[model samples]
Target: MHRRTFLKSSAAGALVMATTSWPLGARTRDRIRVAMIGTGLRGQSQLGPLLSRDDVELVAICDTQQVMLDKTLAIIEKTGRRKPKVYGGNGDVRAWKALLAQKGIDAVFIVTPWEWHASMSIAAMQAGIAVGCEVVAGITLQDHWDVLRAQQRTGTPYMLLENVCYRRDVLAVLQMVRAGLFGELVHMQAGYQHDLRAVKFNSGNPNEPYGSGAEFGDKGFSEAQWRTQHSIDRNGELYPSHGIGPCAMYANIHRGNRFTHINAFASKARGLHEYIVEHPKGGANHPNAGVKFKLGDVVTTTLRCENGETILLQHDTSLPRPYSLGFRVQGTDGLWMDVNKSIHVEGKSPAHKWEQAQKYYDEYDHPLWRNYAAKAAGAGHGGMDWFVIHAFIEALKANTPMPIDIYDAVAWSAITPLSEQSIAEDYKTLAFPDFTEGKWKDRKPIFALDGRY
Candidate 1:
């Protein structure tokens, strides 16, 4: 069947599995009724903010693990807020569907695993609930397309909760870019280069220090329970949005410019195995030491944009390194490198010398950060999480478009699967699918125009 016909015919059957009672339309409630799916570590981070906001009412929460659900409830209890209906127990993985079926939920925050993001977001959009989804929108090229189609068909609000785009320093760079400080953009580089060896392996005990054990899979805790499996199965840029989202905004991607093609290469995959063998809790005889991780120690991807700008992204985990996005924004006149925290502009600094980026960042600090610094004081991820969540809530309340909408979500996320395909094809360049379908030519840049959010 045709794709659209297939969607139309199949949507009804899908909805039958988790039908919402509320009719599809704009809600008139004074407070936005919210639901949370996957109340794990990431979900808990978002819960504090949702609970703190008087304008939001967390109506329900869902997670398969009783421990996670209890942890989330305790967080809610501390705030003295009315407890939300709990879902998920007895190994019911589909508890989120029941949460979606309930009435009075105006929006949902999906902080589930990478694989569940697309499907849950689709279900929420189909149910006429706004979606505040975490991280790369989906795991595959088709998943991205399906999410875009669902939002387009449902006319529901969908925002990718990528906090890095709102990171204070990133926003400062964005301001500099808009003010023509970078001159005409030429090339940009960024990546998720933080060492995650410990994060990929952990003891199942929540009380133990995280990342202190070399156990994974059924014996792992938090992210290690699932996130590590990706390394054993995938050989691409598994997580790209943390680096790509900010770059997309810097280059006005999907807003008159878009990624045209990409090529990717992966280094060897010895980092995980070596970590398993070297850790105190593990040894050469450890079972995990024998588990082959397909993800490379370093995965490099290069993308060409329609506007003649090139982007280089690296996925480096499972190795020893300080945490850094490894951001480098370069143009005709100047460049900013985050690793060294320095910026060099033509004629603005001593010849062939780098200036401290602090002054520049201070001068170009984004208005949002300036206005909300006090309110966002402790909201995780260096306060950027506050900004992204604030944006989602404000847009939903005002019935306005999201700063980082569905197109941006899918575009940044599609890089992962596209890069995967490229590597599988011997690093051959592949055409970047236009999720916007040519609408990018007329789409206007609307991310963080002012301090409104």
Candidate 2:
């Protein structure tokens, strides 16, 4: 079947499901009415727990592709949960206006592809709904600017759900950083390197993987798609936040300082070209096999923060290697390194190495995290996800400040396209667009609730 026709059929089926489900805001419960947009693999598989919680109500679901929508609806069906209204449109396709029009929805969880993050988020915010958007936050430099404007204009909270910040080990490192164990954090390194080409593609039958439910099933896209078929030769830091999150936390990024400027460098695209040329399946017919691709496969960006702190952000997607976030932090008084999983202190009488790090650095108790850890622990991202949601709901409940303010979301996602521009210019340094208008300098961590270790 044609992709468009199949998508339309799935969309109609979704409307049917929505009619059968409970009406929006039916019970008048205190649950935060939430909606899931782009219910693809990541949103369906991972977002289930958060939506299922009693604290929130899933009032609506939207997606451009029908296959994913059906999969998401099935989850709602099995849980006996009040199913949400479903909408389908491809890339600002159709359901957005109607989805945002739902007055019952208090917040929207956007898990769409990188391109649509900014516009969809802006639309939802303008509709008076808080937005929790997926990573690669903004697609273009102007898009980043537009998102901040929308948030400020609407007074709706905007959050980038960068779950890496909540990973178990990353949290452990944050605990240490909070205690001043990493005193005067100096420089850091972070990156995301995971090669999935072999596992992402099946050599034999193109359509062997069937069923949306199967782990390796259709997986949504066809084999002819770009991300799977094309080799990422000289790709600039493809996935950066796995390293950026830990680095940002260690450097006290939002508390006072901010990233100032960055210079990027990318390796030649020869390796990926060779693979496309040599692969038996498609030799001369391969795209760019004979013609060289301009972009490099690996890109490393060096950043200098407003406070003179330096950081290294690397991206290597072409080669096969074990996944590593490459998190490391150094401070004036002490240092906590993820690669070593060890902490070092300046005092001569260093009682214990790792123990000392834990005592001084990894003590999870913080004035901000102490109060909400229990409630947040049940959510995803090893509890951080809960914290993020807590901050959003609390802002609505108390009319207080947003945990991750509009500027934070803008800054976190701005790196997506800016990094790309840096690579295009032969890794020349690119000045970061200041979304805060110099206001972020005084910004605190926005830690609303206390966290206990």
How big is the positional error of residue 246 in model 1, measured in Å on the Cα after superposition?
A: 0.6
lDDT of 2 by residue, 1-453 (tens): 132343334444333433333232334335678888878666875555565467777889888777678878898888888778888744447676578777778778887766567767776765667787877667567877877776665566577766666565666667666667567778888886665444333333333422111122233253212243323332455556667766776676667878899777877765545555565643556543555554466667888998888998777655667766677787777666665566677773265555334453335545445555555556665676665555565455444555556676667667756777787786678887777777767867744334421
Give the poorly placed runs of model 1, Cα more than 4 Å off.
Answer: 1-10, 13-30
| Location of the lowest summed lDDT over 10 successive residues in candidate 1 | 16-25
The most accurate candidate by TM-score is 1
Model 1 clash count equals 0
lDDT (Cα atoms) of all candidates against the true structure:
0.88, 0.63
Candidate 1, residues 31-88: lDDT per residue as tens digits?
7899999988889988767777899999999998898999999999999999999999
At residue 11, what lDDT does model 1 achieve?
78
Please identify model 2 stretches exceeding 4 Å from their true place.
1-29, 89-92, 198-235, 270-295, 348-398
